[model samples]
Target chain A: MESHSGIAAVVKKTLNRRYRAERRFRRIGLAAVAVGLLFLAVLFTAIVSKGYTAFQQTHVLLDVYVDPDVVHVGNLDSADYQGLIKASLRELFPDVKGHRDKRNLYKLVSSGAGSILRQKVLEDTSLIGRRIQIWVPADDDVDMVIKGHVDRSLPESQRRLNNKSLAWVDALKEQGRLEKRWNLTFFTAGDSREPELAGIWGATVGSFYTLLITLSLSFPLGTAAAVYLEEFAPRNRWTDLLEVNINNLAAVPSIVFGLLGLAVFLNFFGLPRSSPLVGGLVLTLMTLPTIIIAGRAALQSVPPSIRDAALAVGASKMQAVFHHVLPLALPGMLTGTIIGMARALGETAPLLMVGMVAFIVDIPRGFTDAATALPVQIFLWADSPERAFVEKTSAAIMVLLGFLILMNGAAVFLRNRYERRW
Target chain B: MTTVGEIRAANPRMTCRQVNVYYGDKHAIKNVSIDIGRNEVLAMIGPSGCGKSTFLRCLNRMNDTIEGCRVTGTITLDGQDIYDPDLDVVLLRAQVGMVFQKPNPFPKSIYDNIAYGPKIHGLARTRSELDQIVETSLQKAGLWDEVKDRLKHPGTGLSGGQQQRLCIARAIAVSPEVILMDEPCSALDPIATARIEDLIHELREQYTIVIVTHSMQQAARVSQRTAFFHMGDLIEVGPTDRIFTRPRHSLTEDYITGRFG
Candidate 1:
């Protein structure tokens, strides 16, 4: 009894220390989670704050008389729409008179404003002689000034906008002619040398085609490989070697797939360079290992009893797997396929080696058309020498993140929908 | 050495001669032979790892599913060699079905669980025929009244006893000549065990059964003839009453009298 009491005292003495250690471990776990959340919060705030303004563009409202003499040139394509825009700006600020000042005055309007007027005249020939009020996009510098990105209080040498140009913008604001509208061009048009005229549509379309091919090619190939390896392949040295290679392939740098694509697809097979077809082929090779690994894991997770039940009922081995095992494993396979596709969507290095890094200005019309993926577009914009491209880069990053979230959400949705209790 | 008790039946349905089972390099089941009679329940009882379940699996070639498990012997159903390579295993399994120790229902509705075997084997010509087979199979298993209202519900949602009955019903839906049950009531409670034991009694009128059980009392209760296995060898086979009371083998007597299993 005395020895038992002594043991009890020892236990009682250590109890509080054990509880304290438990609490300390819990506190450390909470701190780790808190730190992760803080980093995520910082990233999201930085992207959103810089990119939100890119969704709205600055526009200057102008009343321009489409002089028939200037617009009705014999060749309508040769019409001087820029002259009409210049004449309209001169009409708005009649006091600005000299050549250099007039040039600064014309700089307040985007060069694409001429193309907009030309499209208007082409759509309605009668508009050639009438004075119509229209909102036209302002120059990127004027846009930066209006969005508070450029400091107007700085000296002329230190700012993108001169004091005179800032004065014209202030005059336009006073007349309520300056407005920020939804930047539809960012969604509807293609990339351009001029940042104001650029949009992400080209990159978005390229990404869609690339992923479509990647999904179609990799999913079937990966799932078939996984099923054969897991279910039918004899466990021998060759199969073990194959399994090891598959795992090793998954860890290989993605750029090696790009190099392979360059040598085999571009040089030997002679597929079109800088096309979604080639990019999709390259990405398929990159994602196949990931998909196969995931498919195998999913197939393995299915309880062996289901197979036995099916087999005992006289179902063939193939029939049993296709009818019961595949259906159960499908949700998992789809999740893996989507994850691999998401990675392929964000992939850029391989595409670059395949010539997808070319300056593709047209929205990809077909799989073989020259194209640039969203990440590559971001990379290109980020590398540009224009200050306006900074916001565009962040905006592209936001779009990429949105696509990633959408793909992951789809994975969760499919998993929940098809998941069954065994 | 020969088995100590009668090894031949007056009307044998399946006959085994000198069967041996090997797992990798281990001799799991030594040369043992027995006859399974028509429409009779044969119970195999033994201590753990004595090759009773292994011997039972070999009856329907379920041992083929396991890696490195090899069986060699001439086993015949109705005087035809079942081990003939030309004999389709799928067709053989349809002729002889199995129910496992643990209840394993497909992740499907109750109606579909019974219909799956008949449907896959093309036993039904129309939807109505399939539905009829499902109802009759469930009725025969004595689960129709409890689950008739929830035919569309998942079979896995049933209780443990109900699920085991469902698996038995699934095996019966194939219209097999023989049903091999591997400890069909071990996972169940006493009441469910009694219910299954009664079902086995009634089923013996139509289908030949071979059951492997751990409980000697279960063997005595449900079986006509009992075979006792010990250490990879079959020590005795005789009428259950004679084997429990007037045993020929000392090992069988020792196992039955609660001395040492």
Candidate 2:
């Protein structure tokens, strides 16, 4: 009786400590989860807050007389649209007299404003003699002033917009002629020195073409390699070495692939520089190991009994794989391929080495065209010595994140749709 | 040591002589010999890992799928050597079907599971012919009435007994002359086991079946002849009635009388 009571007393004492330890462990796990969620929330808030403004832009509505002589060049493409824009600005603010003042007055309109006027004239020849009112993009400096990014209390020398330009903007705003409109140019145009004219469309198209090439080349090759290794290859030292090398390739730095592309695709084969074709070839090399690894894992996940059943039913080895096992494993392979493509979509360092870092101004029309991917565009915008490019960089990041989410969502959907139980 | 009792069938469908099996360096089966008579059920009973299942797998060469497993010596099916180099293993398997220990229904509809074998062998030319083959195979396995209304449902959705019967029906659809069953009732309840035993009695009219079982009573109930193995050696072979009633090897008597396994 004495020994039993002593044992009971010891158990009673340690039970409370065990319970308390479990509670403490649970609390630590909860804290870890909470910290992860907090960081994610902070990242989203930072990107959305800085990038939402890029979706809207400031515009100035002005009435301009398209004088026939200024726009009536022998070739419509060579028409002097700049003169028409300058004459219209002079009409709006007639008090500006000196050459410097006149130049400053002309600075309120975007330098690309000539293209808009020239486009309108080319579309409608009847507008040559008519005074038409149009909403044109404001210059980046004027846009900054209107958006309140430039401090109005700052001296003339300290601010991007001087008092003279500020007065014109205030006058326009008071008359309800300066308004914030949807930034359609930000989605429709290409890279430009002027922030207001720069858009993500060109880079988006480049990314599309690059990924198209990557998928076409990598998916079939990766799946075939995976099937051969998993299903058909004999277990020997050679195959073991091959497997280890494939795993090692997946961990290799992506820039190494870019250098290989530079040396092989560009220099040896004389493929065009800065083309989506070359960038895609480099990305394919970078993503092949990832797809092959994922594909093999998927093939391995299939139950061995399925293979036995097929073979017992008199199926040849190839027929068994192609008929039953492949169908069951296909959904997994597709998920892996999409994940690899997403990684390739966001890859930057490899593209930079292959000359896809050029400031391309046209949307890529083909695989061989000079192009810049979305991540490269973000890198270039982030490095610019301008205040507006900061918002543009954030907006580009948002687009990239949206694509990644969409691809991952697709992977989940496919997995759930076709994954078999037994 | 030689096996006791008769190892020859009056009319044999498959004959094995001096067969040896190895897994890398481990000798799993040694000089085992048996004969499977046509239109009969032959039951092999033994303790776990006594090479009974290994010998049954050798009938259809199912052991070929296992890594490092090797089989030597001659095994003939209807007087033709099955291990010849030029023999088409696919055709051999088509002629000799199999049912696994567990009910492994392909993750497909019941109809497709039945139709898969016939379709692969091109046994049916028209769609209606294919449908007929599926219906007849299921009916022969005695699973038609229970699943006729839901032939399109997944085979995995069936009960354990129903799934096992569907596997039998899948094997039957191939129209093989011989069927190798590896512990067909080991994973089933008693009622399901009774159903499979009844199906085996009916199937013995048209197919030669060699079953690997653990229950001696089940062997006495369903099989016409019995083979007892111990430590990778065939200890006794005789009629099921005689093997259960008459005195033979001490190991066989000890195992049947519940003295030891």
Once fitted onto the true fold, the runs of candidate 2 whose alpha carbons sit more than 4 angstroms away are A1-15
TM-score of every prediction relative to native = 0.97, 0.97
Global fold similarity of model 1 (TM-score): 0.97
Clashing residue pairs in candidate 1, if any?
A: none
Output the lDDT of residue A310, model 1: 92
**Share of native C-alpha contacts between chains A and B (below 8 angstroms) recovered by candidate 1:** 0.75
Per-residue lDDT of B1-261 in model 1, one digit per residue for the tens?
679999899999999999999999999989999999999999999899999999998888888888899999889888877889998888888988999999999999999899999989999999999989898888878899999999999999999899999999999999998999999999999999988999899889999999999898999999999999998999999999999999998898899998887
Clashing pairs in 2: none
Q: Sort candidate 2 into its docking category.
A: medium
What lDDT would each prediction earn against the true structure?
0.91, 0.91
Model 2, A27-101: lDDT tens digits are: 999999999999999999999999988888888887888887776746578877877788888888888899988
